[model samples]
Target chain A: MIAFISSFISRVMNTLFKGRKNIKLGLYGPPNGGKTTLANRIAKDWLGEEMGTVSAIPHETREIKIKEQVTIKSGKKELTFNLVDTPGIATKIDYEDFIKHGLSERESKKRAKEATKGVIDAIKWLDNVDAVIVVLDGTKDPFSQVNLTIIGNLAARNTPVLIVCNKVDLKKVKIKKVESAFPQYPVVGISAKFGTRIDEFYEALFTVFR
Target chain B: MLTLEFVPYHEIANLSSIGRIRKLLNIAKQNKIVLLEGRLKKEEEIELIKTTMEEINEDFKGIELAVIYPTKNDSGIFTKMKTNFVDMIAGNRLGLTIIGPASIVKAIKKDPTKIQLYTQELKKKARKKK
Candidate 1:
């Protein structure tokens, strides 16, 4: 009962104050799903600065980083929000997995600890964001547990979501599979690395936020 | 040897979200795959992940979880209504949930109708030479 009341109140508050100030838009997904790459793309496009470093190593962004008051203009329409780039969420975080990426045991343990805390932080932030952008790796299967969990949590909160099928530059990208997997939300295919089809993503953002 | 424990929905129906998460995590830490009769609430699922992360260590890595529920794609109106009625009576007990320790369960591949739980082969420790 309390949870439902709080969720209702938050939705009301979000609706009452939409577009009045910076909308807190969050980037969330599983590990190595290109969330940081998309965050960097959005930050570079609007603020002329990158949000965080991207790496092939999972959990590289082991903290919740934010770029404030980013404004993007499409024709006469303009949208401003605080773009929050969060760590990749995972069901399991093993230090040994980091060792496979060539990190020393000691460094791997430290990274694993930080990554665990990062997942907790990302889940906590779900309550604060008015809207969210779920980034998915287009080359991977979208029906994984992590993806379903993330989408389910968002649905439970009734938070607005835009699914970005990132890494479209790759040859084996399966954007359609992602779309079919999550047909409920709006899915856009884009190469956040090379900035291909980014305009479509920005355009889709309007539909979500509006 | 692998163990699978079946937990009925009534076993956790009255527990709070935190309580439910703790119960499931404790079972996973015991290195057994939990075959729950019904799925958890969405908020409970998030809490379960958070709790699992907090308890991760060398021996207890984490948990891999998946829920298999019936989709309402082609069901008739009466069938949909019957499902909803049962949900109201049984507190949404229309699905199955699986939670296993990450050390033992490599991955859980799930489709709408089936689940493929892949278990990793346990490595044998070397015996000492006298």
Candidate 2:
């Protein structure tokens, strides 16, 4: 009876003292490629946050948008995943519109001049991430300049990249060709717009995170 | 010389026959030199190409099966094409040339009319500048 009681106490102590592992994941891709869509999906279903804005416009997310302290349970382990959603990378448009969305015109114009700086800021944030989800448009060629640049940068950083082929529900989207082109990387296909294969996406997230 | 460009489809799920053809059409529109290279001779090579093409559609232009090195698989063609593609995409003149069987090369060489027409049109557009 004493041994049983001691074991119970030890288990309770372990649970109390064990710190939750916090993993930081970045969702990045070219403008209009559904980064926000995927981020919002994960935030809503797994992170328990309301869905953020989803739009067809490019550069919908102009700054580093973050949803912090999301708790996830796997088996007997509890983990915390801090999901960071970044603005789409646009060569032309800087954070002017993004700043204007929340600020006055003078401030928006001031930030616009620093648009290139915003991209640099986003790249710097990559160093802090544990893994990256590089989203690609399902209806366009996967070899676009922007997409390749993003992947190349991620690879250079030695960051594990999970290529998410978004908007797969569209009739014009193709998965096989993308798999063939990037044979070395882990690729997942999902329609972020409709949330299909979302559970599978989460499974992939857990696999890479673990 | 016959130039080939492999354009991977937009979506990972869209790596079907139809998706590949659509992507090819789009690439053809942007550049007149691009052609769809033939399939691999070996069944396994074909399968591997197909699988890889589906995942990394943007990375592959087409698979070239070289007759001189029949035993030597041409999977490296994708990486080479990717480099050339990047150069061209950056507004450079980097072109893609695929090495394949003699017969395939001869067949492509025989069709100069399409390339000639494209070049002629480009010259015509250039002449307008002068």
Least accurate stretch of 10 residues (summed lDDT) in model 1 chain A?
Answer: A1-10
Which residue pairs of candidate 1 clash?
A: none
Off by over 4 Å in 1: A1-19, B73-82, B124-130
Q: Which tens-of-lDDT digit does each residue in A115-148 have in candidate 1?
A: 9999999999999987889999999878887888
* Model 2 per-residue lDDT tens digits across residues A1-210: 434533443454345335645567788876778988888777777657754676654554667877887766657755566888876654234233455467666755544434344454566676788668888888876654345446656656666667898898998888866665455566789998799897777666555444
Docking class of 2: incorrect
Candidate number with greatest DockQ: 1
Q: What DockQ was computed for model 2?
A: 0.03
User: Chain A vs. true chain A, TM-score per candidate?
Assistant: 0.91, 0.76
Q: With candidate 2 superimposed using the best TM-score fit, by how many Å does residue B128's alpha carbon deviate from the native? A: 20
